[model samples]
Every structure is written in C-alpha cells, then in structure tokens.
Target: MLKILATADIHSPRFLDLFIKSLNKVKIRPDLIILAGDLVDKNNIYALKHVYEILINKYEEIPIISVFGNEEYRGFENKYREMYPVFKWLDDEYIILEMKELKIGIIGTRGALDKPTPWQSRHMPWLYNYYRELPLKISAMIDEARSKGAKYIFLVSHYGVTYKNLEGEPRNIWPYLASSRMEKIIKDKKIDLVIHGHTHNGVRDKINIDGVEVYNVSLPARREVVLIDFTPKSKVFGLEKWLYSGG
Candidate 1:
C-alpha cells in the first residue's frame, strides 16, 4: 500500500521540533510527505533556508509537495520560490505523483478564507479576489487530475473546509476563516479525501461529501501524522492510522 503522511500550518520554528519528533517516532517511511502550507512564519530567505535545511536532512528521499500559504504571498513570495527548489509547489495547478500501485493526484491552494463574510470585507480585502478564484481553480485542477489516469485524488489546503470541524471556534470567526467553498468543489470532483490545517481549534473529523472523506487535520493540538494506505481498485484493500495521537 502507498502511505501518505501530511501536515500543514506549521508556522516555521514550531515545525522544527515537530518535524524532528515525528521523524524519530515514525516507524515506517512514508511514500510521500505533504506539507499543505504555511511552512514558514516569515517570508524571509532566512526562514526558508532553515526550512529547506531541515527538510533536506530529514525528508529528502520522500517526495515532498506543497503550496504557498497566505503568509508566503504577502511580500516575499518570489524570493521564497527562487530560493527553494526541493519542494513541488501546487499553487493554482495540480501535481500527479505516480506511486507503486497508486496514481495519486494532488490539488492544493493555501489560506482560502471564506467570502461573503463581514470580517473579510473589513479586515482582508486584499484576499477577496484570491478567495473568489480558489474554488474555480481547484475545480479545474481536479478535472486535470482525472484526465491524467489518476485513480485517487486528494485536495490539500491550509484552510478549514467545513464548519463541522470548526465546532468549538466562535461562530463569528468561522465565516472569515476557512473555505466554505470546499464542499462543493470536493463533491464535484468526487475526490477521495481532503486534508487541511488552518483552524488550530478545529476538530479532526471526517465529513462525507457525497461519499468523499474530508479530514480537518490541524496538527497543533492533536500533534499527529495521518498515514493513508491506498491500493488500486483491483487490489481491494485500504487502511489509515493516526500516529502520535495514540490511536
């Protein structure tokens, strides 16, 4: 089975310890390691260098995929991209990784705040157009993946997908935070699973969007890695485990 391990919203220094700890404890090497976004706290070259060093030493062998978080796009995005070459950034496009028996297509975007929310209008008007474009861009990526012989598709983002996972957070904060557009996009793509982390207070639960499994995997509180086992339709087997969550 192909095992996929993922994490997101790890704002720089915080991720250093987590990365080391995770590496020491992981018994099996994952086929791929996915960083949803927010890899660095600051968009400076120094922070990117540190992140690059850590990843190169620890996860070089495994294929690493990522996208830029809102933080990365603030000012120094061009510099960040110019410096880092190890990571495969998804941005508005899709990436297809062919594993042993699984053709996994990954589509991702970062910091997709909800639209039609008052807080957004008042606070983050800069992101208004970006938020508007995300849903359509992701939909196009999904179609591209399906056309590329991918059997399973995964959506990765650095924003909460649904309010079901954001139950504990303040009601008013919900609309301005995660992407409410996620459900429709996933349903349309018939995506196999969705993985994301933005709402630190969000719960780790699965939302079945027309039979698709959406996992809100904000790792700060739970501090765990998700291991997803995949096999082709002809193989007939599946398994997933949460490591470091004591499950």
Candidate 2:
C-alpha cells in the first residue's frame, strides 16, 4: 500500500507553527507528501524555506511534490523551482513514480476557475481562454499517463475542482472558486483520486465524484493534515476518520 499525506494553504509563517504541531502528531510515515499549494502568503517566496525545513527535518528525503497556487504567483514559478530543487514542482505537468512496484502518475496544476476573479480578468485577459482549455489539456495528460502504464493516477491542483466540497462557501461564487469542467474530466477519466485546496471556508473536505474520491485538503478548512492509503489494485483507504484520532 502507498500511504500519502496531503495538505495546502499553509500561507507559511502564518500557519507554520500550527502545521508543525500537526505534523508532529502524525503516527504514519507517508510514502509520499503532497502540498496542494499556497505554501507561502502573497508571493512571500522566502517563507517556503521554513516550510521546507519543517518537512525535511521530519521526513528527511521522502518524496514531496507540489503545485503552484494562486498566491505562488505565475511569474515566480521558475524562481521557486530554482530555490528548492528538492521538492518536485509541477505546473500542469505529470510525473510518474514507482513505489512497491506500483506506478503512480501525479498530474499537478494551479487548476482553473469557471469564472476568473475580477483582478485576474482585468489584468490577465488570456486567463479566460486558458481556463477554458485546461480541462482538455489535463485530459490529454491523463491519457499520456495511462499509455505509460501508470496503475494509479492522481490529480493534484491548487484550486478546488468541484463545488461539492465548497458547501460552506457562498453558492453563487462557486464558479469563481473552481471549475465544473475539471469535474467532467475526473468523471470521464475515472481518476483514482483528486487533491486540491484554496477554499478555506468549505465545510466538506471529502466527497466522491462518481466513485472517484476527491479531497479538499486545505489546512484551514480541515484544521489537520489529510492522509490516504492506496493499493496497486485501486483500493483506497481514506483516513478522514483516522486523522482525527490523534493524528
């Protein structure tokens, strides 16, 4: 079985202490760590060092993969990559990892919003078209992973992919928070699992999209790290209840 720990929206230094405390209580040593994004606050790139220190000190060289969040800022993507080569950062990219002879394909992205924010629409006019095309681009990536013999496929994004988890947030603003387009890809591809964050006020952290498990691992919403255990046979043991038990 492959054990994974996932979380996002650390906004580093702000929630760094709480995150440290939370990690200290985890009894399971995950095979993989997924940071959905927003590692630092408002492009405070340097703060990621503190987050890196905390995780590295505890997990050592355990593979940690991440994606860019909105606060990560598009222009600084390469800078973050150069600064931290240890963490594999994926922005609308895919990487295949072999663990226990199981090939796990992780597709990471900042994700798309059905409706771009006012600031984005005004400043980044191309964003509207980009968001519209993201679903198809991601779908192609899934096919690539499958062709490469990936037994399990994971979609990791910075933005919430579905509105089901955005229960507490204002219903009318759901389009601005995530894209239903992504949801269609998940269903069509039958992705093994989906992990994302950015919705801090969401009430449901876990939901099922056509039997595929989707988790909103925002640190603020769940107030804890999310744990998942998966096997090569496509059996997933969700640890939502287990996490609350002194994790």
Candidate 3:
C-alpha cells in the first residue's frame, strides 16, 4: 500500500507549527506529500522557501506535489514562480508522477468566483473570469492524465469542491469562497479523490460522489497531516492511522 499525506489552506504562520509537528508525528515516511494550496501567508518568497526546505529535509525520499492558492498569486505571478521552484505547480495544468508502477495523476486549479452568479456578484468580483475558465481547464488536465496511463487520479485545489463538506459553514458564503464547478468536474471525471483547503471552518470529512471521495482538509481543522492509503483499482481508501500533534 502506498502512503499519501495531504494538507491544505496552511496560510504560513499556522502551517509552520503544524508542519514541524507533522514531521515528529508521522510514523512511516510518506511516499507522496500533497499540499493542496494556500501554502504561504501572502506572496512571501522567504516563507515559501522555509516551508519548502523543511519538507525537503524531513521527507527527502518522498515526492512533493503542490498547486498555488489565491494567496500565492495575490501579488506578481512571475515573481512567485521565480522564488519557489521545488513545487510542481499545477495551476490550470496536469502533472503526472509515477512511483513503483503506481501512477498518481494530479490536476489542480486555484478556483475563483465570478459575477452573474449570486455568489460572485456580492463578493470576489475579481475572480469572475477565473471561475468561468476553471472547469474547462480541469477537464483538459483529466484527459491529459488519462492519456499518460494514470491508473489513479487525484484532483487538488484550494477551493472546496462540494457543499456537503462545507456544511458547518454558512450557506450564503459558499458561492464566494468555494467553487461548484470543481465538483462538476470531479463527478464527470470520476476522480478517485479530490483534496482541497480554502474553507478554514469546514470539516475534514469525505463525501462520496459516484464512488469518488472529496475531502475538505483545511490545515486549521485538521491541525496535522492526513494519511491516505491507495492501491491501484481500489474503491475505498483507509484513513485514521495517524494523528496531528495537536489534534
């Protein structure tokens, strides 16, 4: 069984503490580490380097897959790319990493909210075009991953995929923050798992949509690394083997 660790919506200060704690708590070294998004506080290259260095030292053998969040792109996009080269950035693109015959295909987009919809008009008008373009972009990534012979597909994003996982949060606020387009793409692609972080108050529960599992794993809620076990052609993955230091 291949062990995978996932975390999202870290936002720098909270992430530093949890990251160190995760290193101490994880019993077995992870084969793959997935950072869903919002890794740094703003567009701080120094903070990004610090987190990257820490991960490289602790999980030397494990391949780290990541996507940029809205926070990372808050400033100049070109500069952020220059600062952090360790990540295989999946911003509206697909990246496939194979390990021991097990192919982990990752497609990610830092989703946005647009206008004409009630959610976008009230808040996050800046992201109007982002939401409009994200669905098609994700679909293209899925096709690319399938073409590359990926037996297992994982979708990573900084936005929440479904309202089910965002149940504890207010209903009206959902549209502005997370994207329903993300859920549509996951369901259509029949993805194995969708991991994301934007909603800090959201629960870390799995929602099965036609056999696909979508997990809302904001760092504040989990407070530790979430370990997932996946085998090629398996439907249900195992969880709850490890705990975050604080949780």
Which is the leading candidate under lDDT?
2
**Clash counts for all predictions:** 0, 0, 1
Candidate 3 structure quality by residue, lDDT tens digits, 55-137? 88888867788877867765455666676666667777777778877776888767654323564457656567767787877
The list of candidate 3 runs beyond 4 A from truth reads: 114-126, 234-247
**Candidate 1: worst 10 consecutive residues by lDDT?**
230-239
| TM-score: model 1 vs. ground truth | 0.85
- TM-score between model 2 and native: 0.95
Who wins the TM-score comparison? 2
For candidate 2, write residues 26-116 as lDDT tens digits: 9888899999999999999999998898788888879999999999999999999999888999999999998878788899999999999
Which scores greater on lDDT, model 1 or model 3?
Answer: 3
TM-score, per-candidate, Cα-based: 0.85, 0.95, 0.86
List candidate 2 stretches off by more than 4 Å.
234-241
Task: Quote the RMSD, in angstroms, for model 2.
Answer: 1.7
Q: lDDT of each structure?
A: 0.70, 0.89, 0.73
